[model samples]
Target: MILVIGGTGTTGRIVAAKLAERGHPTRIASRHPSTEGVRFDWYDPTTHPDALRDVRAIYAIPPVGEVDPAPIMLPFLERARSAGVRRVVLLSSSAIGPAGHGLGMVHARLGELFVQWAVLRPSWFMENFVGEQPHAVSAREQGEIVSATGTARVGFVDPADIAEVAVRALTDPTPHNTDHLITGPEALSYDEIAAVLSEVSGRPVKHRAIDPVGLAARHTANGIPPDFARFLASLDTAIAAGAEDRTTSTVADVTGRTPRTFRDFCRDRLRGDRPG
Candidate 1:
């Protein structure tokens, strides 16, 4: 059985669904399951064993909003190894590296912990513009998207593409003991993205750039922890410094199809469902 951690999340749900579609006996693990799944919590170690039962491969998503997930994840991973889990596909981010903070620490040690391992360092998600995140909320309510990334470009990929790659990593016969840098076809600036959003939805959307400190403060006001907010702000600051100004073909190479653009993603979402 393939175990999908964070199975109800943005990418995890798609990964679980794709695994099932491919005839894999998939097990969904969540902190609060809405369906027939195991209750798995990162802070609760006792739940680990039951979730790992009969599971051979795992699609691992580190605890959300965590600054450092390696310490919490390592013990569970060790137990997974002891429980006979062989393959592990960890979802990481392009901004963080093997030696960087957060899930990067998990990426640093993923290879030696399992027989088959892959670290997916996907770029920013386009879903952020339509989901419950601050970007989406602001766009829907205020007709603007705020960020610290001033005039910077990003290759925002769809979560479905990321999920497809995750499925391949989990089920592929060979151990792809390497990191995959996933991204969409083109890099686009926030201003460009806002213009596209305006065109697609026929709304007057705009990009509002602010300082990193201000962005962090806004995130904190939205109930995000101070440190996590600062971390997110730092990512935006990095983007402003041209950190995410490139694109990659990983999605097409892995999935045999071109990754969707921001316009396509927006068009699909706005076709029937109006933004709240």
Candidate 2:
């Protein structure tokens, strides 16, 4: 049996569906129980056993924008290991540094567990177009996508590819305990993204580059905590300094297919004329 934490989420949902399609008995972990499968919550340790019971493989998706995910992830991972789970896949960010110091802590521990593991270090998700990215919404609604990343290019990856690779990692043992840097077909600046939006969505979407302090103020005004807003601004500065422009063939190397292009993503998700 395979257990997927954050199963209701974008990547987790796709992973669970793919696993089930391949005849794997899949369990979904969420706070709310559902008819699809067993529901479990990561925040509450009491729910771990019921979710991990009889599971042989696991997919771990830690909460996003989290500076400290260890407290929740480590305990759940240890529990899964004790339950005899042998294979695991972790959804990590590409923003994690070279030494993998911060979030790498979790991957390091998973490495010590002797399980067949694959850490997916994916770039910015294309899902931002359709999901919680307020910049995209602001563009569609108000004719502008604002960011602090001035002239920075990002290899924005599609979540579907991430899901496909994750499923293969869980089912196949070849790429055991390795890190895969997943990215899209090309790197694109936010300005280019805005242009794409303008073309696809049939609206004049513009990219507005704000200073870091100004961006922080906007984020705080949008209800993000001040500390997190400042942190986000700092990340933008790093990106502006060319931190995330690198591209890789690892996605195709692992999944035997090229990653989707941002144009394709925009065509599929944003081409429709839906009012946001």
Candidate 3:
């Protein structure tokens, strides 16, 4: 059976659905127990045992709100290994290296523990414009997308692409045992993203670059912890330094198909209407 951690989330939900469509024995793990899955919280060890029962493979999405997730994840992964789980596919970020902080540490550890593992280091999700994040959606509504990224570009990948790659990694007999730098078809700046939103939504949209201090203060006001807020702001600062402006072919190589472009995403999710 395949255990999909964070299965109700953006990429996880799609991964679970695709596995189900393929007639794979799949179990979804979430914080809340549901008819569809079991309650599995990484911070809570009691839930881990039940979630790992009869599961052979896992799609692991680390717990949110923790900058350094190794403390919370390493123990559970050790338990999973003990439980006879062999394969693991981790959802990580493209910006973080194997020895870097946060999820990078988790990625490094995964390689040490499991031979049957693939780390998906995907670029920023295109869903950030149309999904839960306020910046891009607010741009469609209020004509301005605010960011600390300045004019830097990102190869914004689609969540569907990430899910597809995750499924391949989970089911493949031979493990990749390497990091796949997943990206969209092209790199684009926030200014260009705003222009695309304007064309797709038929609205006048603009990109507004903010200072890191102001961005941190805004996140703090929205109830995020000070340290994490600063960390998030720093990501944008890195982007402004030209950190995330590259594309890769790993998506196509892994999934046997080209990754979707930002234009394709806008056409499907943003065309002829305001972002929800």
Candidate 4:
């Protein structure tokens, strides 16, 4: 059976659905057991064994931000190995570094584990456009998207494609112990993204530049916690410094199809109904 952590989340939900559709017994593990799935909590180690029981494959979605996920991930890996799990797929970030915080530590360590593993290092998800990022939706309603990034272009990937690649990796299980740097087809700036959103939504949305600290405050004012708000603003600063301005073919390379373009994402998400 396949167990998907964060199964109700963006990528995990899609992966679990696809796996189930393919005749695999998929179990979803998360803090909320309200759904018809396994109830598991990362903070509660006692629940881990019950969740890992008879599981052969796992989709690991570590907690967000630069927090230490090793304590959670390492135990899961050790237990999976002990339980005779065959395959494990981990969702990693492109921004992760060997010495950086957050998923970076987990990503680096997952590489050394004595099991068949695949790490997906994807760029900023297209979901951020309509779901996560306040600027994108605000732009649709208020006609202006603000960012600290000016000209830096990012190959914003779709979580759907990331899930597709992840599903393939989980079921197929070839070329094990490899990291895939997934990215969209083209790189575009927030200016271009605003234009696409405007066209898709039939609004006059524009991109506005804001100072990093000011953006941080705005994020907190909009409900993000202070520390996470500062971290997000720092990420924008990283973007402005050209940290995430690269493109890659890994998405297509793994999925046997081209990654979805931002325009495609805009049409499907910004214009059409999927989910928030």
User: lDDT: which candidate is best?
Assistant: 1
Most accurate candidate by TM-score: 1
The lDDT, on a scale of 0 to 1, for candidate 2 is 0.84
TM-score of every prediction relative to native:
0.97, 0.93, 0.95, 0.91
Model 2: residues >4 Å from true position, as ranges?
Answer: 98-101, 274-276
Instruction: Give candidate 4 regions above 4 Å deviation.
Output: 131-133, 272-276
**What is the per-residue lDDT of model 2 for residues 1-276, given as tens digits with 9 covering 90 to 100?**
999988888899999999989999999887665787676766777888888889999898986666667776887788788889988899987876324445678877778874588898899888887645777668767898888899999999999999998999898857467888889989999999888888888888888999999999998998888887897898788889998898899889888999999889888887556556
Q: Is candidate 1 or candidate 3 better by lDDT?
A: 1
- What is candidate 1's local distance difference test score? 0.91
**Model 3 lDDT tens row, 1-276:** 999999999899999999999999999999975797999999889898999999999999988767889888988999889999998999988878887567888898887778799999999999888855777657756788888998899999999999999999998778888889999999999999998888887778899889999999988987899988998898899889988999999889998999998888988986546535
**In angstroms, how far off is 86's CA in candidate 1?**
0.6
What overall lDDT goes with each candidate model?
A: 0.91, 0.84, 0.89, 0.82
Tell me the tens digit of each residue's lDDT in model 1 across 1-276. Answer: 999999999999999999989899999999998768999999999899889999999999999888888889999999999999999999999998898455877898888888799999999999998867778778878999999999999999999999999999999887788999999989999999999888887778999999999999999999999999999999999999999999988988877999998888989987764545
Tell me how candidate 4 scores on lDDT: 0.82
Ranking of predictions according to TM-score: 1, 3, 2, 4
Query: Candidate 3: where are CA atoms >4 Å away?
Result: 272-276
For every model in order, what is the number of clashing pairs?
0, 1, 0, 1
